[model samples]
Target: MASSRCTQKYAVGSPASSKASPLPSFHRFLTKVIQMNQLHTPKASRNQETGRLSFMAPVSPPRSGEAARGGLSRRNARRVKQSAPAFISSPCTFPTVLALKKIAFTVTSAALLSTFVVSPASAVDKDASANRPKPPAGMSRVGGELLGRTGTQVKLGVGAPVLPKDLTGRSWIVADAENGEVLAAHNPHWRLPPASTLKMLFADTVMPGLQPKTQTYTVQEKDLADLGEGSSLVGVKEHLSYTVHDLWLGVFLRSGNDAVHVLSSMYGGIPKTVADMQAHAEELQALDTKVVSPDGYDAPDQVSSAYDLTLFARSGLQKADFREYCSTAEADFPGAKKKNGKRETFKIQNTNRLLTGADGVDPYKGIAGVKNGYTTHAGNTFTGVAERNGKVLLVTVMNPSSKEPHAVYKEAADLLDWGFAASGKVTPVGELVPPRSASTGTGTGKGPAAAREEDKGKNGPSHNTEAVAAEGDGGGGGGVGIALGIAGGVLALLAGGVFLVNRRWPLPDLVRRLPRR
Candidate 1:
């Protein structure tokens, strides 16, 4: 009955035809049917505003075949009103962008995200938030368990060194840098303060933009003024200009927040530097990191996981300048000149105990360079890389037991030993999950873009992808990455639902009023 009424001639019989899209007009016709069933259709109730009829207001229901009182028609206007699409007046035009309805849910989701703020996108109101996916019993996403868990045993073969209990740090990862495979790990994705070790990520992002020995910046009082309290300084004096190389040395050897700010000011600002670092982190698939500060001071929400720290080191090591500065145990720090116009000089020692052989810690065999960190909240964090017999290994130790400050390096040393020995045997128990790629579909577990990026590095040899998690391993398999994948899928679906609502109920303020089962 409704189909016949809708198809029957309307404009052909009485009303003047128009050029407005038929879809919008049909929407109004449906609205009148719904309104007629709910309220009394009043007589000739034309809306003074909009110069159109107000079909929503009290209106008298059609009597048998009588014309519903309104303008723009001669006979009962029933045929045109009911068939062509009943309207208080002309139909409102819907934007062409709404054509996204025919696209894939993923495509629609991307569009809706731009159109709706949280208020407009309030598909999940507080009342129905319970329907949202909840973590397993007794589990919470604050641990990032929805995405993945950090602490898990991994082994490549029957006798591989996938030990986590032996490591004292709260999080650690030992990966074969030559092959882009995680040999072993413990809570590698557990978010923890990185202290200065995050400088690796800073350098990785900003170093590309800087011209090392050529890009010089004068140190200003404002540059050194905002150093985090009790944070390390590279002895950068006010009014002294330093080259990019020198400031990086300050970052690598002294873990200088002062040097970071000076360089950050050179690059942009701390905020922009942090944003770039975060963007680079996303690019590197360092999912377990959030950069709130360039120097990795114990700022709220500033965090990095062992897995992410390893990724930072791996990426940073690609540049010759980064490797050189990190490997340099001692360097000349240019100081503020005397009134007599003589330049003063001071030596800044590398804080990495293993690399510099400092504080009774024996240097790990074949140790090259990376970074280390310490703070009240972070305790101690260290990222290290070593090459022996042409095999390069990377290890990251974060927030070691506070009782022993040197334990962080000690933990890294132990992992380095195991990584080299177990390199041939272990598979990645937990993977370094890549960031979302545009080309990857919702179902694909990984993206080719990520694979291509990791396979190539800045001025470095291509990392071997053979020993990756793709092959079978004897390590304790980790399903955390899979869990996070599932959670991510749920979010995509929720976003798709938003666009569907926009398409189905194009009218304002009508979504909430629809009946529910």
Candidate 2:
């Protein structure tokens, strides 16, 4: 009986030990499953596009070492005693995928930063294009011609073609003084009489050389001879004398032919003055201009084109002294000395209808000094400048209708209105240089057969020459043809004009009028 009891006790103890041993095997199997799953779980490719991570069905409970398989039944029995929640509590094996997502986000963030940094460089280039100039077509050749022929050194680019066919007259040209771009053209190469408008060039060139004080000059018999009885005059008496400065004032303010001769002679004779004028014109390359007379009296060989005239006007306006002269609507020339040396003060007024507001034309709002010219050859020509809203414009109207100066002024206003409209309309024409007609009479000299004894002293000196012959004297415009010539635009005195409009902004309406090509 004692031996049997001992054997039973040993068997019970063995069962308890076996049951406890299963617990360690289950723990080891769980650890092995985690390691295997970690090894087998796929790592996403580095190049994968960004987004969310999707999970594959939970990987097959990884095949375990044999011990794990063997313990499952015992563990299941034990787990059945415990709660099911406690057994299922480990991480779902998704941490590795989470790590991969973080890495992708970091890479995506870096790529986004790089893209933002490089974008602005392209935008700056686009902004630069807006302010760049467009080349006007046919401009290069015109520029070359201006530089080569007239000494007007205008340089230009291709913007729009300026067709010559649309123009009228022997030659025609339109330019924007503010912008300096030639808008339309015809036979711009031809040279014709610039007439009295040439005086503007003389005034502009000589004003700087003047000493401005106490420079004395004498009036000669030649100065007073055969001055048209009815034509305008400063009443300079022969053998009388005046300061050189006053003579210039008279020449510019009154358009005095006598003062012109006196001044021209004082400036080293007409030839030297003419040469100087020509050289200056050459310097500017004003090719079509030939300055034979400082007064711009209707010399047959002296001629200028519409284009060259614009250049001349532009070049002259640059001088302050020149501006003072033409701008003077009224001035006092301390009287001419009589042959007996008596002094008398005389008032000289500018004949430019625009300056004096003599004609019906409305005065330009901000107009400064300029000259007016009319001759049988060059009818109703004007070179003018005006400023408004901090912008300056130089304009030239050559051979507009003599019957109406207002017509020309109105046309000029139209151009002015157009220029103010845009930023890019008129290109500057080189440098701004702001810068006359005649007739004969019916009366004969008061001397000869019935020479009136009282008239001899009152009517001034008498000459016996035929009145027509006297009327046709020096620097005077050819007569009889003006009225007839005006009727036919084909004649030398055609009623056409040229205008130059320039500004900082493109001229408004300028583009609308440009040639289609």
- lDDT of all the models against the reference? 0.56, 0.45
lDDT of 1: 0.56
Superposition error at 383 for model 1 (Å): 0.7
Candidate 2 at residue 386, lDDT? Answer: 59
Candidate 1 residue-wise lDDT, 54-93, digit = tens: 1111111222432333222122112211222233254434
lDDT digits (tens) for residues 253-349 of candidate 2:
6667777777776777677888888876655446558787777766668887665666666556544455556667666777655688667776666
TM-score of each: 0.57, 0.48
Model 1 misplacement above 4 A: 1-147, 156-165, 430-517
Q: How accurate locally is residue 308 in candidate 2, as Cα lDDT from 0 to 100?
A: 66
